[model samples]
Target: MPQNIVVSQPEDLTVAWAQRVVKLHEPHTLVTQVDLVSVEVGTTTRIRLAVTYHAETALPRRWFVKLPSLAWRARFITALPQLLETEIRFYQELAKAVPIALPVCLAAQSRWGLGSILVLADIEEHGALPGEPHDVLSAAQAGLVVDGLARFHARFWHQHGTVPRYRWLAGRVRQVEDHLGTVLAVPLMQQGLRRSGAAVPVGLHQAALHYARNRRRAMRFLSALPQTLVHHDCHPGNLFWQQHQAGLLDWQLVRIGEGVSDVAYFLATALEPEQRRLCETGLLARYAQQLHSHGITDVDSGQLNGRYRAHLVYAFEAMVVTLAVGDMMPTASNLELIRRTATAVEDLDAFAALPI
Candidate 1:
């Protein structure tokens, strides 16, 4: 394949293209074969590849590649916002500066009409375990993730505009996405709640409906806080575990936002309600302390708690919206997340925290 050639699906990853990508990292190596080990399609198509080299090298045998979704609905949802493109940009431009573990980018490229390709070192090859959406985290595991996110948030704390290079983190694409989300909020939320059946408690339906009706205002309220780089979709499935350390994945929703939003989303989606109730306060304190250790000292525990409670609304909405969209995640996972987030919202009175 030529330098200009960009693959759009697992089948397009020809040996020639594989060689071309490999040669960039290992000058002496030539790819002899390319085998598609497995492929999973959701909002994006994740392809696991096995590459054989002509000569001995230290390069990984397996590689992970992400492409735009093959599912039409998922593709349509992500296309306008250029979610995969944004993630490609993250790998190309900012992955190295991140504090926690992330897959090593081997090659990343995007073209407006040609689509995008992200080649990464398969973390499984490095003995890391990928987190599944249905896996509930123990309090100890959730605490580790909270710590990792704190370090990440602290490094980029309040640096949104000051860092000219990262100004795009809060750029127009996010604004447009937020606008579209608000526009679709009511129908999607209603549909999701209906689809949720008995998963969401009856008591929370009116509050959820009201929040959906006033989503634009709710969005504004959520953003009216100190901003930092956040993994806006911080559920368990988007994480990987290695030696008890949590590494983040799925940068498609990475953007500038209140850092506590990540904490709220993670806890709501990642933990069992009982476990979350037991450990969230301590984990939150640990997050603040981690931020302080990283020289971010202005965060107040009381205010942080309020922000966290408020942010749980988005977490609930996100899962509901995912369910509404369909095909974006497993129905079972989506329902469970909706259940957990709904419970969190009611438990914390998350909607009350919103200005609306």
Candidate 2:
């Protein structure tokens, strides 16, 4: 079961967080009901809250609120403008011309010492997780997701030299690799393998060391790719399908990176190994077709296959991530961390599974 990770608060709360949410969103009328406060994983304060509007309002909305941790907020005081600027830029790129559906950016706010909050339109639930572990997505739904990726990427194809501003977006992948290095990398690798009843194979540590040394090369390889607006973490957990539309959420890691990185990370982490094994080629072909529809006819099937290989550049990232988060492990999460590490390396050896 997923734990509702909540923290305690004193009754005399000085800051009016509740009022702040309403003001940030510009409520059509004052919010009358705010219940179902559920906490989510983050180094900072993140929650999903349901807000009911005025007495007659029927179309109530859910908003996902993400705020920095108290500690993070303190360090960000001096650098506040830069941090907010980067975030605004990302949202602008994703929102401007793309016809795809993302959580509408209801609000992005910075209240000085209180840090920043990004309030997003929540994708409503029909029900939580209707699909089977390997239940296939309907053809149309898959097409929308893959097409969305292609559209976002094709926007940047040849504009590399011309659009100087977008050049740095390519570096977002490096920022990701760096962030994961601290929170999810080495420690989880050491932990996940041993817990899965998988032996710590010989040369594991050496391989890890080598991977670290070549980390720059791996990052460079991604930076070398045609950068585009990538929804860096688009696993099934980050996606929700409702009738004819699909809602893509969780934009914290959104940045400019290789398009394949999103496809790879999403498919690898979201699908069962069996599902990925069966559908990898088929999905890639479809995504390529979508690219073609958008006039990106330069890439052939051979180059498409190459993106599959390049996805492995993020294998270590996925391993640590699976360990850091729950649900991947059967027993103790931290204990099983070692198992996830070994399994990630296993995929590195085998040519199966998405790089995610």
Candidate 3:
């Protein structure tokens, strides 16, 4: 019943390439309607179900099934399967090493290779969420998120020094920085950014022209550092705080990189420094201490925190993104990031005066 849902088959169950996953994940549900909820529906294909369950008793929870974008929606060399695989691995790996309380992943499949399918416990709807956007998280809400990141990062303090794959993700940011000017000439990213709130700054408007060149410079710095498995995007939207437990979503972006990357990016872009400073050190120390508890005593909190401060590159990226994405549908925490990054780029002249 949703506006743009493509129902390619007359049989009712299978629709285009999405049938395999639909029948695979939930065979019983008589799916009556589906909605594509995310703002970036075009980049890849996704469907959200509103089903009529055949169960007798009231179900204890709700689950959502996600598969690779529809055939016409495929982009970027079919990385969707690998994307799901890495996500499953991240949760499996993180749970084993760190023991953080995360939503139980019910089932995941990479049968389609780069075109993956996943059926995960829908934590937000089950746990009770507003299902809307806002500007700030209360103090307790923020604590729930930072504590999880703190604990999540703590486990990898041992064995893995720095993850190669993670460093590659950070480098991709430069690609965004690089072909930006050329790509901005296109509309998808431009449309998304224009609506995200934080606008592109004037001086850095042209910096994206040299993205490939700057990427080498930026990643060379990240590559020389210590590393571990990190939940790189630990912002509020990806974190869910329920009554008894908290959960993290969208692990597709997980990577092994500097401890500083998550810390700085989270602090700089998710919370206002002034507000985050209150509990930032304490939360960070807690993360380090958690690492020590796991026997990775060699990890230094001061060094970790120091590098985190230096890795504010994303802060610059966030400022410019506001222009392309429009109002960013910011969460409360993201609002702080936008305000702080704007001041840093304008008042402190950080990105404006950078020696590129």
The prediction achieving the highest lDDT against the true structure is: 1
Tens-digit per-residue lDDT, 271-334, candidate 1: 9999889888999999999999999999999999999999999999999888888889999988
lDDT of 3 by residue, 159-271 (tens): 36354433443455334533443343334334423443553444543443343236545555654564566665555555555674556566665665666577656555555
Determine the C-alpha RMSD for candidate 1 after optimal superposition of all C-alphas: 1.4
Q: Candidate 1, TM-score vs. the true structure?
A: 0.97
Give the top-scoring candidate (TM-score): 1
Model 2, 256-302: lDDT tens digits are 66677777665555544555556667888888888888888886887
Q: Between 1 and 3, whose TM-score is larger?
A: 1
- TM-score of predicted structure 2: 0.71
Worst 10 residues of 1 by lDDT: 1-10
List the lowest-lDDT window of 10 residues for candidate 2.
5-14
Count clashing pairs, candidate 3.
Answer: 28
- Estimate every model's Cα lDDT from 0 to 1: 0.90, 0.53, 0.48
Clashes of each: 0, 8, 28
lDDT of 2 at 247: 56
RMSD to true structure for each model, in Å: 1.4, 7.0, 7.0
